[model samples]
Target chain A: MGFFDKLKEKLTKTKQTIIEKIEAIVPVGKKIDETTIEEIEEILISSDVGIKATEQITELLKKRVKEGALKDYNDLKLLLRDELYKILEDNTSLNLSNKPSVILVVGVNGVGKTTTIGKLGHKFVSKGKSVVFAASDTFRAAAIEQLEIWANRVGADLIKHKSGADPAAVAFDALEHAKSKNKDIVIVDTAGRLHTKFPLMEELKKISRVMKKSIPESPHETLLILDATTGQNAIRQAALFNEALGLTGIVVTKLDGTAKGGVIFAVKKEIGIPIKLIGIGEGVDDLKEFNPKEFVDALFD
Target chain B: MFEALSDKLEAIFKKLKGKGILKEEDVDVALKEIRIALLEADVNFKVVKSFIDRVRQKSIGKEILESLSPAQQVIKIVYDELCELLGGSSAKIQLSPNPPTVIMMVGLHGSGKTTTSAKLARIFKKEGRRPMLVAADLQRPAAIEQLITLGKQIDVPVFHSFDLKDPRKLCQEALKKAKIDRMDPVIVDTAGRMHVDEELMQELQYVKEILNPNEVLFVADAMTGQDAVNIAKSFNDKIGIDGIILTKMDGDARGGAALSIKEVTGKPIKLIGVGEKLDALEEFYPDRIAKRILGMGDVLSLIEQAQKAFDQKEAEKLKEKIEKEDFTFDDLKEQIRKMRKMGPLENILSMLPGANKLLKDIKIDEKEFVKVEAIINSMTLEERKNPKIINASRRIRIAKGSGTTVTDVNRLIKQFNEMKKMMKKFKHGKGFKLPKIFPF
Candidate 1:
């Protein structure tokens, strides 16, 4: 089991225990009292679902029961799942509709943002798509070299600027080259941002805005890469990034290593963003599309 | 435990804290520190660049000069941002709809794939499901036997294909057996390659094609840190894995692997293996993990551990006796036995979150407990119930019987008295703190 799976497993266990307890309480259409409702809330919170989300869920459950929609525990569970699913149902696909689709990836330090971009490029190239990668994360000494190595392995074209070059300038160059080369995809690996820093978030925003000027609504997807092992903190990152850059979709990595993977449910439940891809392993082929039903099933199963 | 990282943070914060507004020069200096920190923590260089860039943009504003403690403020901002980039929220495992769900485990050799498979089996079993283990890792000699050994230890059934030549055949037969046995879940532990070998990749691909597993989990080691991300990327690109399982988390405090892999490979980490013990696997709780990284003591975890160890009935009975002010040495002996059953004293201490710093140098070995137990055992039954009976003359005799010095016996009695007094004070709503340096 991976870390994300471990996280998810804990979450699933909590979900199951709560559902089972609720099931036992509302057997055969019996009305539940305040005590039972309170117990359910405690279960949700103990499962690390966050106090706010738990309160919100219980409130929703209370409303349903009052409206006579939830006749029993089973009915309440289904309703809860549906409500949780609704919070998770923002279906933001990886803007693949664009010709030469340009995706600008961003995250904070050590969030694997650049590597995710490299993985995306590798994925596209494996599908026989023409891919070009720009080393826009130029501050670090070995970053350009690292992307170059990945590009070589995946057999994709790559562009890089001198170390310490303006990242935006590098991105502009990559887009211009991508336009002339008829590349099917131009994945610009940008500098990771500190979402807490207005200036850092602003730089990311500026990069997105600049890309739009060059490619006319370019950076078709602002994919925010998050480490699944981060648990609830991943949510804070998403909120900060979404507020600043209008993150179109999310790419959750390292799900193979964590049980907190249940955080996806909480995140999608709270953030209302679509998870485009999940990283399952270190192999190039480990990335998979976010099939919500499949995901939920794997979690419960 | 996280000394490697804390040292780096201390150095960076030390320099940053001494400054006012962060200038281009300051950014360069800070970036250098971050670059070194990430490298030391084993964060991939590519990942570090974007991270620093993001932080620089946020820290380079006039807001720094406007702040009272700009360095601390900036550090706080970076910490929060770091938390966000790791993942805004946790990713969960996707369960299959149908019964007899198949979960395929894959990873590099020595990544603890087989062990993690067994741990998952135990988890599912405790959840009241019949989980069958399929020893699909046929490449290594005794791999099947290893899985079988773990299965027997956990009391879960293992399906092996010793007669089968190919791994895919083993998986097919295993899944078939799983369905026949009515096992609600099946875990197929696949063989790992030395690196990213073609034959192993083909074998994994073949197994996936045959099993059509509900979940394909990639097991990894946290000590590898950033390299694990690249490894995940390579595996995902080839096999299309579903989730991740990181092992050896109990060993590394920096937990950079937890930070980098998710963003690098685009996978949800589902489980974490804390130790080498059979029951060491734990559900990944991000908030608790973050709190641990920040060196905040986890009180809830301590309470949970105590709950697991102390029987409620026994605890209630003991509390009643203590309430009556009838605490005895026998009770202390029972508590010591309970602690032994709870496993290593160091493990309990380390899990206390911020207790790491306090207990870092205190070596609480079994010998210490043994000495205390010997002193009590040498006492008469009446003396055991009431240590006040063991006065100087009685203590001398008891010390002779236990093969210890009279002073040793006297020290034990003194410690017991202090502990009793502290308990009494706590019961009476008085503040009673344990001595900073326990004599024993």
Candidate 2:
């Protein structure tokens, strides 16, 4: 199946919960009234679209209502989709202009950073681009071994150190290996840490800084991996990680589950960070390039 | 991030403060703001709607509207409603009357089940129970190894078999071994899966039936958004969870999922994972969490932690010394050491009411405590007891010994004298008060 179709199927549960609820709230042939708008607002908030983004969308709809541009439920639905798409629209492609583009993956623990790295490496390796995996997540037990498995599967060289070694050293070595091997991409997988931990955040900054020693202006893409099920804290994660590392993009994972990944709407609206990828399932091929059009379609259609 | 909801509420109520009485319109306005704040905290809209309705009903009552400090009344109503929705109090895990009570951990992937299982085992082991950990999560790569590693760290035995691909069989064997080893409270760490995955859910059901766990805890991320209701409901319906364990409470997330899960599943949150350490798991207290959400501060938790760190005999000894006006740098150093044992100084301060707002712009440098300890360690016993003996040259020598500046040593001596003066006043039957020690 095509990526869109797969996304639609993976998001089928989310659609059934959110889209069906929206449809039920705003039925056909019903006039869009203030009560209907309020119900739609509840649906958006319940879907985790967040208060600010939901207000932005509803405010637009209210304006349309005032202008008499919004006539029916279908129009409101389309308008909502359009607004979400606009917020989500950005440069959703990875920056690989350099010969050995470095992608630093960071997030809180248990957000599927390692698995996403594996899938991401598979994507690049399958495109005939040599890749190098940096197992810089020296904190978690067996995290390196997990990434090593992914590297072997994706046919990418992995640079790792002992479990308690410095993560910056691991990233430094990976960059050196990538340069020597002339690899197309180097993905650095850092241990998952809560953004609230100042020391850990400092460590991530150090890793980013050390990469520049090997390649000036290295770590071309700093992606924060966010769990779809995560709530408002995702915004804090994005804001802090962006402030710390100048995060280039975000990768929303576990969309195959019931979570609509609705927090991304708030993340996009608040942080203005483009989502480069969406991980739909556990398979290596489940990772897909994020397309706002297809993503909105999967939600509304 | 956890302070956001309370901060917003505090802002709203600031306008209502000092008002003589609350009108119906005032209650409506307050409820509207509360609704938005709760929604922003990621509480489910339906839950927020009902919660607001209840709060409004109470706030609109004549007794509440006519009460003195109507704003405080409204806050109390909201806190009570929140506490009601969050459950009455903290609930403990129900150990079966029969030996070998089984606990099965289930949740969506990456919810910290494996780590939590180990933490739970450590807790039980500490309580003098032979708790065995079962690595039933055969889905995720290296998950078993991860559990084994954690088990090893805690010195707890973990049950795993490579030949047993089926989790049902794996769990069955693990239970048999637990019984044989006389391990009570066997914890089975199941693979994290989507709640909608029928095959995986069915597999969990099979294992649940086989083991007949005494407590099926639904582990969830405390940062989970509005989807918490659906996920919690699905797990409760699919495998019938007995309780919940919210992880990553150390994050700034306001943890509205705790409220949502409780509302939907009618299950109590038995525990919370506060940090990454193996012993960071803590018993869930709904009232304390409610206070935290309202920014009223978690004084009870703070007191509990303080009591654990401060020995009663030592405290009495120090009190007697203070009453006799013998407060010295050595005693201050000992008190600081005891306070340090209660965890991070910032965390301890954050537990005080209105401290979040107070400390928002101020960063508490814990290094100051280290510097104080070093300075105290450098002081001679005679010099510590008699600050008058520390001449200018003695200060310089002590500063060099402690690797601090002479100015720092002078400041410490001055602060110590001022603290002694304050204790002298308290010894005269005046109210006791702690003097500000940190420069910040």
Candidate 3:
């Protein structure tokens, strides 16, 4: 199946609920009133679309209603899809200009950083690009082993140190190995840490800095993996991680669950960090490029 | 964006403070602000709607409106409702009358189940119960290894079979082993799975049927958004969870998921995972969490932690030294050590009322504590007791010994003297200020 078709199928639960809730709130031929608008707002908010983004979308609908552009529930639905799509639309490709381009994956504990790296490795390997995996997550128990399994599965070379060793050293060694091997990409997996932990954040910064020692302007892409189930704190995660590492993009994971991944809209609206990829399932091939138009159509169509 | 719900409520109530009597409109305005704050905290919109409706009904009553200090009354009503909704008080895991009580941990992917299972085992071990960990999570790569590693760290035995692919069989065998080994409260760490996956959900159901776990704790990330309700409801429907465990509570997330899960599943949050350490598992307190969600600060938890960290005898001796105005670098180092025992300084500070706003601008460098300890350790006994004896030469030597600059040593000495003076002033019934030696 095509990635879009798969994404639509995976997101069917979220889409059905969203569309079903709106339809249930207001019949197709019925005019959208204040009560209908409030109910729609609740549906979006409940989906983790967030208060700010929902307000923005609702405000636009109200404006369209005053201008006589919005007539019925169908018109409101179409307009909502378009506005949501507009907010999510952005450059969703990786910047791989440099040889052995470093992609640093960072996030709070349990957001699927290692699994996403495994899938990303599969993608690059499929494209005939040589890849090196850096198991810099030297904190979590068995984290390195987890990444090692992913590396072996995806046909990528893994450079790891003993658990509790310096993560920066692991990243540095991986970059060196990738350079010596003349690899096309290096994926650095750091330990899952809450952004509130200052010492851990500093450690991540140190890893980023040490990468520069091997290749100037290294770590071309610093992606923060956000769980789709995360609420408003996704914004905080993005803001802090961006401030600490200048996050280039985000990879929202676990979209196969009931979560609408609506927090990404808030993340994009507030932080302006584009969503580069969406993890639809637990399988290695479930990762797909995020397309805003298709995602909206999948929700409404 | 990081505004605590308490700060927003404070702003709203500040306007209502001068009003002699509450009007319906006044209550409506307050409830509106409360609704927004709750929603911002990631409370389910339906839950928030029902909650606001209840609070509004109670707040706009004739007696409440006519009561003096109606704003405080309204605040009290809201606080009570929140506390009640959060399970009234802390709920303890129900221990089975039979030995080898089984606890099955279930949650979506990345919810800290494996880690929390080890923590739970550690807690049971500390309570003098022979607890065993069962690695039933056969899905994720290296998950069993992770559990085994954690079990080794806590010195608890982990039951696992590399040959067993079926979790139901694995759990059944683990339980039989636990009974044979006299291991009570067997914690089964299940693989994290999406609730929408039917096959996986049915797998969990079969395991649940076989295990008949004493406690089926639904582990969840504290930062989970609106979907907490759906996930909790599905788990409760499928496997019938007994309680909840919210992980990563150390983060600054408002943790509305706790409230949402409690509301949806009617399951009490039994414990919370506050840090990465094996001992960081804490018994959940609904009042403290309610206060945390309302942005009112968790003073109760802070005090409990402080009491746990500080020795009463040591505190009495420190108090005597402070009264005598003879607080030395040795004493300061001892206090710092005890303070370190109470989690991170930033985390402790965050429990203070209005500390979130204070912490927003100031970066608390935890490494400063290490530096202070090093500088103090570098000091000789005589120099530590008598700061006057530490001359420029001694300061230089100490700086070199501690691998710090002379300026840093001088600053510490100066601050130590200033703190002594402030203690004296405090004894003399004057306002006291903390010494600026440590970075905020």
Candidate 4:
């Protein structure tokens, strides 16, 4: 199956909450009305597209309706597609423009941070790029071993430290090793859950600074992997990481789960960070470049 | 999506602040706002409808509360109904009078079954019970190792086998080992698939049959929103769950699952994983969750004054100062310093209703607090006593001394003013702004 088809199948759970509901409301050629717009608004919010983004879409739909441009719910779908795409406009593509680019993966614990890094490494290896995996998530138990297993499977070199070692030191060593080995990419896997309950993770900041010591332009892309099923709290997680690390892109994972992953629009709308990828399944092939058109299309499909 | 629910309510309440007599239309507007907020937060539409009905019945044209404003009574009614929807009271983990209360942790992969199993052990350990972690999740490549490692950190013993692949057999042996070791609670971390499938369910059924766990915690991710509810229902129907453990709770604030899980699946959320650490687990309280739903957490702290035990004289003086609108940046700085020493500033700030709005909107952390602390400490005694005496050059000096940006210094003073404004409302008992402030 094609990637989009796979995404569609995986996102069936997500689609259940969105397209299914919308289609049920505005089938084939139903005329749009006030109640229809309200139902559509509720659907958008239910999918976690968020209030602001949903309001933006409804606002546009209302304007179109007022202008006599939207005669039916069929026209409403086109308007939503246009408005949703606008929120995701940015540097959405992975910036592989620089060789030996350092990719930093960060997220809260249990958001598949390590798995996404492993999957990314596998993708790079398949594309004929020499990749080195950094086990900077040394705080999480057996995080190194888990990454090491992925490294071995993908034929990528892994730079790791003993469990519980300073994660920043591991990241720094990995960058130095990647540079020395002339690796095409260095994937730095930071611990998702910092030991400190304190919200500010100086360690994350410290790691970024230490990587610059190895390569001034290290960490070229810092991608935050968020869970697809997350609700309003996704904003808090995204804001913290985005503010602290100045995140370049975002990847919403576990799209296979029964959630439209509408928080994607929320993150983009609230933080203005382009979502670069989506994780639809557990396999290495599940990570796909986030296409806004395709994503919003899939939401209604 | 996180604060969307409370923020909407806050907006509505803000409008209703000085409306002495809330007309039916006013209540209608508030209910409509509440309905949208709840639905937006991913609360089931049916549940939201019923909740609105309950709040409307109690609040519409109720002139009984003479001391309280109409908006305050409406919020109180909604809060009480929300609490009822959230399982009324906390349903704690069912501890067996007999030792070795088996807790079978089951959920989808990446739902945090293993880590929460460890967290459960830690919570039980804090209660002086010997908890053993059973690594039944041998399906994942390193799930066993992950559980064992988490076990070591928490000083709990882990039972896992290299050869044993069948979780049923592994759990049986682990239960026997727990009994032998006199462990009070044997936590069995079961394997999880990407989605609910028959094989995984049957295997869990086997393990559940063998262990006869006292509690089968359906570990669900809080971020999953409504999906968490459906997954919980699936698990509860297929394998039967005694309760739920909502993970990554601190990540998102909407807590749609917290509302939906109990109302839809008929299962209480026993605990919540506030953070990733094993010790990050907190007992789920309906009152607290309800207050959070209404954005009343900060108002609770402000009204309860549990932290007032720190300095009674200072507390009384501060209350009087706030009532008389005598609060200043000096008092603000001192209160923040004292609050930081007492507990997390969010908890202290969350006590004040408006503080939550400001904190939620602003990206402040401990590092900012450090900068705030340094800026205050750098000030002379006079500056500390009277922040009004400080000027731009003095701010630059303080920033230079503290090694912080001017924005940091500015934020401190700005936050100080906001605190004073909010505290004045709290002290007067004039029903503060409906949405953000405590309904006094």
Clashes of each: 118, 0, 0, 9
Regions more than 4 Å wrong, model 4: A85-91, A193-199, A296-301, B1-11, B39-42, B62-68, B195-199, B292-440
How far does residue B312 in candidate 3 sit from its true spot (Å)?
Answer: 2.6
Tens-digit per-residue lDDT, B1-440, candidate 4: 13557777878988887687777788889888888777667676667777889788788754524636777777778888888888888788888999888888888877888888998888788789999998888876688899988998899999999899788788878888888889888888887765446666787788889998888888887766556666777888888988888887664456677788888888888887766556667677788767776776635434444454357788788777767777654665676566555444444454454455666554436565666667778888788766777789998998999998787777776666565667666777766643221101
Indicate the DockQ of the complex predicted as candidate 4: 0.34
Instruction: Tell me the DockQ of each model, to 2 decimals.
Output: 0.01, 0.71, 0.80, 0.34
Highest DockQ against the true fold, candidate: 3
**B261-318 per-residue lDDT for model 2 (tens digits):** 8999999999988878787788888888888888899999889988988889988998
Return model 3's CA RMSD, one decimal: 1.9
By summed lDDT, the worst window of 10 consecutive residues in model 4 chain B runs over: B431-440
lDDT of 4 at A12: 74
In terms of docking quality, how is candidate 4 classified?
acceptable
Which lDDT value does model 3 have at A282?
87
lDDT score, residue B135, model 4?
A: 88
Cα error of candidate 3 at position B178, Å:
1.8
Residue by residue across A72-161, what tens digits does model 2's lDDT show? 878987888889889988655989999899999999999999999999999988999999999999998889888998999889999999
Worst 10 residues of 4 chain A by lDDT: A193-202
DockQ score of candidate 3?
0.80
lDDT of 1: 0.70
Residue-level lDDT tens digits of model 1 in B98-180: 98888999887556788888988997898898999998877554577668778988999999977887988788788788888
lDDT of each residue in A87-113, candidate 3, tens digit only: 988656889989989999999999999
lDDT score, candidate 2? 0.88
Q: Once superposed on the true structure, which residue ranges of model 2 sit more than 4 Å away at CA?
A: B321-337, B364-440
